[model samples]
Target: MAGVRAGFSTDLGGRLNVEPEVRAVVDATATVFTDLGATVDDACIDLLDAAEVFFTQRAYDFAAWYGPSLHARPESFRDFVAWNIEVGLGLTVDDLLSKDAARVRLAVAVDDFFTDHDALVTATSQVLPFDASWDYPRSINGVPQEDYLDWMRAATLISSTGCPAVSVPAGFARPAGVPDAPELPVGIQIIGAPGRDVEVLRVAHAVEAATGHGRRHPDL
Candidate 1:
């Protein structure tokens, strides 16, 4: 997200022609945030806000961060479609997580970094009160905060710079011995950075906000 731009994946994807320009604004906003000392998630929210602010002023439904991704459209863009909501501005940690998986709560960040054999993430999230998971390319050696940042930065550099990140609740994987109902679900994510997190959440929120999803999750 640090160096990502909205149009980075244009060759691979495009907005519904109607909103292409707005998508570009989001890309520019990501660049602006990088220049402004904001992290990916921080910059993303603002960029999203700017888009909603624009349309909201127009009275076009500020649901940019809150819209639906599922809709009927011209068939030309049909093949590219999937769960696309995430349209307007608003709040909700769940929605944010639905939009970006990189937004971690940092429960075991410090402890994970200092443990033996580079097991930082494993050590930390494993012991935390809630259920958690990690995606270290190497073995999970939960690193300290500094080390965790180092890990993220290094990973960003090594991987494709434009990887979109989202961490939506994947539902809980309860420990067998525990007596409590699942505390809260962990997240599932699809990494991308065209700043389309809004589209992602719009549809996701509509569904998650619906009656029974965790019971029957579908691919987005």
Candidate 2:
């Protein structure tokens, strides 16, 4: 991965195509957050709206191959591409313009955040729950649920800024509800503005040294 320039993937095909159980988990988590009065602020909602367009432009259709190639791709890949395309086409002219505007705002936000910093770091996962045997495109009831877009919500949101991000070991998390579950290793993602890959790596190294998480191994 070390080269003059490095590349990263975002929301593989723009939709994770995860099973319905994942969605149910997400919905249940949201309910808990809502009931606990941990509602998301309006600013965060706006950021999510902006992130959709930013990620689509910079990563999903970065090469402008979404149109013709979507038709020729395998059934698995084509569905997500077609879905993204359908969403894009459904937007009004004003909506399209707003998305473009959001892209510019997102770029500026990234620059402003990293203006005086080496990098920005955050927990890799907001929740500590896991299912080791969970399968992708999983079924719920009987039909498969293909839209698991929230899986990379944070990372892809940052990708809209064209910044570089690296995920390094942060430590383990105790399972919230499952008493028998093992302590799961989590990651700390370091994000830096565009062309600041070196700075991102440095920050990751510093976190590793401070936490010494990399030195620890999980029991099998």
Candidate 3:
């Protein structure tokens, strides 16, 4: 990882929330079996812990194979990523009526996201790759991602203003005793604290390096 620093961002992926109720019991007694909610929580946690799987598309594709660490750091450090950004919600009188009201407002934002994505999709139709491959094109100038990001924002509506949203590499591991190998590039992400993208990137870099999977490639 020395002298190899890569900046990556994704719009398809976001930190997952396990429903407030499921989170309430993750720390329950060991004697208790994992209930439906607990199982759901575990799955959500696992999914978030596996963010690297989705960080696949980038603005730039490396010339040679990037080490596993270069891909993502698979580790579960926290619940979110730190974002040095601005996030907010503008509420109208309708949304103030009930929780479902928030959904209506959210839909508006989501529609906006779709619109943005569609615009980019249209513009990039000739250039965008429809499948995954090492020779596929890459772009990180922040142009192609507008739409993916729009959808992500609409799906994961932020409660607090731009705060910390982080992603940790979740190394691939299977059920205990299954001897499942680790997926070098797996990452779990968390998002928090806006205006601190540097911090988020720094921490993510360190975690990814420690996961020791960034330098390997599929030989495409």
Candidate 4:
């Protein structure tokens, strides 16, 4: 990460419901970049339309992969999976065209952001880890998560930009006011311009080395 110009953002312009501790970890990670001789600053790319583009493409992919099996035996797949496939199957030509156009706009914005900054950093996840048995978190910080996809907007939004991103272990934190709570792992996301996977990975490697968080494993 030495001499790399890095920009970081805690949230997507207030769109993400990030937990306090999660944001703290990402903030600290940016400091690590500064300490490693990288120029760090708070920067964010506009991704307001990311959800629409991501979900639409996701649904389309799901249908392409599982539509035949779903149609042959509706009960074969889980409810949520089937629902996503059905949504893809029902997409109109105009719907696809609109989302494609929005995706193009997002790509251009990301390209522009990278012109000034070599990489963008952010919280890998909006919230701390949850119980493994639950399908997904119902809410975060009192904000309702409408569906399985809601809680993962942080990563999904980045994905929609067509940039390369890597999530490296940043640190750990416990829930507030829960003295007995176990510390949950947090990650810092490093995003690079399109086709800049090598640069993103280099930054992530530096982060992992400096923090040493990736070396620690949890007890089962």
Candidate 5:
């Protein structure tokens, strides 16, 4: 990791409501990079339109992959899956075109960011791991999440950038005011420019070695 220039962003410029614990993990990961002889700074690519791009493209994909099955046996799929297929089926040509344009802008912005930095770091998730019975966290930091995808904006927004990103265990977060509360795992996302998968992995590897968080397993 020596001499590698890395940039870290905890909240995607405050576009996402990241939990304080999650943000702290990413911030700590930035320190790990600096200690590894890499230059770390606060930086984030413009992802304001990333959610739109990702959801639009995903809806299109869902329609292509499941529209036939949905039409044949709607009862076989869950409500959210059926909803996604319906959304895809209802997309207008203009909707796709506009999102495509936005996607292009995001790609360009990510490429530009990488020209100045080797890797981008972010919180892997906006909130801690939730109960298995829940579909997804209904809220993050007291902010209501509108749908299944809302809780996952952190990763989905990055996906729209078409960059290679890897998530590595950063540390653990224990709930506040609960002395005996179990420690929840937190992750740091390491992202690189297009075709820079190896660099991202190298950064992830360095982080794993530095923190040793990956070696710790939860008590089941």
Candidate 6:
């Protein structure tokens, strides 16, 4: 992601509406994990407390390594420095010790979660518009009209866990408010334990076979 940001930074940084969508997607996918952790096959779910920390730290490290060449939003970049550097560096000796303890617990939780469940299934994206025309030819500092970040929620969440996940076409549905909008594709995300990429892919194949959604094509 940082690499992609760097590539498009000069041309698209200020022009692209990227943060809101990404945040929305992450929040929506977090709910799926939280709910699944609570219920579903009596499985024990692992919730990482520092998931955002992992994400932001990676972003911050990328920024530090690459310098200001990659910028998402000015405000966002400031917050990254403030949270991961300024505030993080201010942590007391005791606080640092506690953080280490928390990470140990987090590791155990993650291990337990994978042990309990073979795979996880959820929406690929919470929201995406069929009308591509609305998103193209963006202007500088243009705010996204409506949030579509939920579209990558599953991917981001799974990424934090260092687990392998795949998204398969589930089916299609018409946009909720668009008049005469065509049906848009929906995806099902399948996630597996770390190093279980094969299992994830096999389940995704089974899902694709069962749904037969791949056979369909857009009206275009």
**Which regions of candidate 2 fall more than 4 Å away from where they truly are?**
1-49, 58-82, 88-95, 132-146
Model 6, 8-127: lDDT tens per residue? 011111222333332233234323333323223323234454445344444445546544433434464544344444434344556656555655665676577666567665545545
Question: Per-residue alpha-carbon lDDT of model 1 for 17-105, expressed as tens digits?
Answer: 21222223223333332353323332111122222222222222323522333333333332212212222334455645443332221
Best candidate, TM-score-wise?
A: 5
**Candidate 4, superposed: residue stretches over 4 Å from native:** 217-220
lDDT of 4 by residue, 1-220 (tens): 6779988887866778999989887777777888888998877888877888999999999999999999899989988889899999999999899899999888888878888999988888998998889888898889898888899999999889888998899999888788788788998888898899998898889888998889885632
Instruction: Report model 4's TM-score to 2 decimal places.
Output: 0.94
Candidate 5 displacement at residue 54 in angstroms: 0.2
Global local distance difference test of model 3: 0.28
TM-score of structure candidate 6? 0.57
Q: Give the alpha carbon lDDT tens digit for every residue of 180-216 in model 5.
A: 9898999988889889999899888988988888997
| Every model's TM-score | 0.24, 0.60, 0.28, 0.94, 0.95, 0.57
Pick by TM-score: 1 or 3, better one: 3
In model 5, state the lDDT of residue 81: 87
Model 5, global lDDT: 0.87
User: Any idea what lDDT model 1 has?
Assistant: 0.29
Clashes of each: 39, 1, 61, 0, 0, 2
Query: In candidate 6, which residue pairs clash?
Result: 21-149, 25-150
At residue 200, give the lDDT of candidate 4. 89
Q: Is candidate 2 or candidate 4 better by lDDT?
A: 4
**Order of candidate numbers by TM-score, starting with the best:** 5, 4, 2, 6, 3, 1
